[model samples]
Target: MKAHNSKKVIQYSYLFHKIGILDDEQYKQIEEYHGLKEKKKY
Candidate 1:
């Protein structure tokens, strides 16, 4: 996946999680699938 797209997905997922729209498990799945969570400065 492109880094740009992955970054957006991560950002949006975090927003959803923060707003109570997504649970921890779902947020973890999205983060893992996106593979950008490993980058500390992404």
Candidate 2:
């Protein structure tokens, strides 16, 4: 179960990064919907 969860996290993280959807504006929109800000690297 733990491994499965980790895999899912990694998969989604890769998908997000590949799509270039990690900018400040998109992050804010995601935060507004999900109720928390994501830690950004750039």
lDDT of 1 by residue, 1-42 (tens): 477788799899999999999999999999998874446435
lDDT of 2 at 39: 26
Predicted structure with the largest TM-score when compared to the true one: 1
Q: For each predicted model, how many residue pairs clash, with residues at least 3 apart or on different chains?
A: 0, 0
The TM-score between candidate 2 and the true structure equals 0.47
Which stretches of candidate 1 lie above 4 Å from their native place?
Answer: 36-42
User: TM-score of the candidate numbered 1?
Assistant: 0.77
lDDT of 2: 0.50
Where model 2 places Cα greater than 4 Å from the true spot, the runs are 23-42
Candidate 1 vs. truth: CA RMSD?
Answer: 3.9
Q: List the residue pairs that clash in candidate 2.
A: none
Q: 1-42, model 2: which lDDT tens digit per residue?
A: 544554465556556756885765664454443332222211
**Each prediction's TM-score against the native?**
0.77, 0.47
